[model samples]
Target: MSAPPVHDPPAAGVVRLPHTGLQVPDARLRVVRCRPHYVNRWEYRALLVRGEQRIGHIRGPLPDVAEPGPAGVAGGGPVVSFHPRGRAFTEAELEDFAAACRLDGQGLSSARVLTLLVDEYRIEQMVRGCARRGGVMARCCGEGWVHYIPLRAYPRSAGQCAAALAHLERASGVGGPWRIWDGQQWSPLSVGSGPDTSPGCA
Candidate 1:
């Protein structure tokens, strides 16, 4: 019924298996397996420990409070877009938007970021640039201790990111009846969206 501890509880943020016994239905947005060969290899069950450290059984499921969270307007935080339209965002405003995702102190509870463009051409360009030049808006997502953007969301160069895999809690909009890719499919982010009235304030 319950899985025994393999090693001392992972250090904060290190991915670990869901508790065997007191499993909460929705406590964790996701549970993943980490490969010992990979860098983020903490996604598996605790490994077997040796010596006098046998007391390292997992205490119990993390309390509900341990859920990762996002700040500023639910999980939306602030969204950055490549759409060169109605409003232009200063560097500061863009960074602030990224900051909202980490307020909850959880690992990136939501890593699905919405990127919009003026048209298919620009969107394609962004995609191409990410491929040729390496990295994409996902990199711009932020590096705040893996909070602004979950390590999982980070696209390895070009169009390799599976943002949809992670839970998208909150989001903001900009550019065109811009499309929204909320871990599901591409749809309109807003029904009756309009351009921004102020500068750099998406």
Candidate 2:
């Protein structure tokens, strides 16, 4: 006889559900529910991930039927668009998902939600500061958008960001960005700062 299957624990700030479907055997699929950076009240996305790679995603208001799936989700919802590679979700799978994340309209805890809101506000403020000051490293949020991150907040190739410390150092005209201070004035950086290196002139 085979032993019962074991599942991995969910990551921090991420809620996950075990998938019991034949789509991908060995219980590899994980149904994750979390608040995205741009989510409305009670709105969240259900991401389907196989192992470490994300396979697909569906968005909608939780505790209610999600947006009609492209392949006609398990619910009576009709199909609007179709993708050749998309897989249809079975009724059982949908039911399990609903049961896992059952919640009322108010949504997650007020304290937790408030903390996330404050964090987002601070990030936006920093991005705006980058635009007003010089040293913006990149422009995001579609074309023509002024949203950016200053070189001081740029992440290293290893995905490390010492943004707060960098900000203080740069303000003192010591270190940070693609430039340095040589007692009298700031000068171009002497070496590449890994992935955060500034773009060269054309």
Candidate 3:
């Protein structure tokens, strides 16, 4: 049987997202809740909202979507909860992953922990995906630029991967999309800054 519609006095016109064609009706969410998905333990299921009027909660990270963890939750890893958008790994989560992999992450620098995390992902592909190495869930990619991705979630496409570069833990640039940082901290790297660091420096 269909679940009884949880609405009183009903709702008005549903809001249709033009790009994705997903229609969401008017639902006031005073509080939102989240938990891991049951069937696809890989995904998370948010309780949608609290106190009555509500829209259905979201599933996993959508393409170009924002991080889905509850608001106010500090984002750092080795204990990251993976979303489509990359999430910072928490130290605890990092340790757990290390233990499962029979490796160690104790007292390591954040960058070093991230490197170790990437190494295990390389050494064990499917095992890492299926098992719980850390609380922060992640998927694997081959190598290169992805080596130091701060957010461990796998980028599904070029756009997704490019979007993540800005948030990378060891990224070597500045600003993003439009703003450029000419390779020097506090310096400028903009559209016509060109092959000369001399102008940005001085």
Q: Which number leads on TM-score? A: 2
Off by over 4 Å in 1: 1-118, 139-202
TM-score of each: 0.15, 0.21, 0.20
Clashing pairs in 2: none
Please list the residue runs of candidate 2 whose C-alpha ends up more than 4 Å from where it truly belongs after superposition. Answer: 1-24, 36-42, 64-202
Worst 10 residues of 3 by lDDT: 180-189
1-202 per-residue lDDT for model 2 (tens digits): 0111233332233332111011121234444433442334544444545466555554433334335432223255432111112445543443343222211111222112222222333344444556466433332222212222346443433323454334545554434343332222223333333231222111
Flag the better candidate by TM-score, 2 or 3: 2
Error of 2 at 171 (Å): 54
The lDDT values for all models are 0.24, 0.33, 0.30
Better of 2 and 3 by lDDT: 2
- Name the lDDT of candidate 1: 0.24
Distance from true location, Cα of 37 in model 3, Å: 3.1
- 180, model 1: CA deviation in Å? 12
lDDT-best of 1 and 2: 2
Report the C-alpha lDDT of model 1 over 100-192, residue by residue, as the tens digit.
322112212111211110112233344444446433222111223211112222333323332322222223221122233222223222334
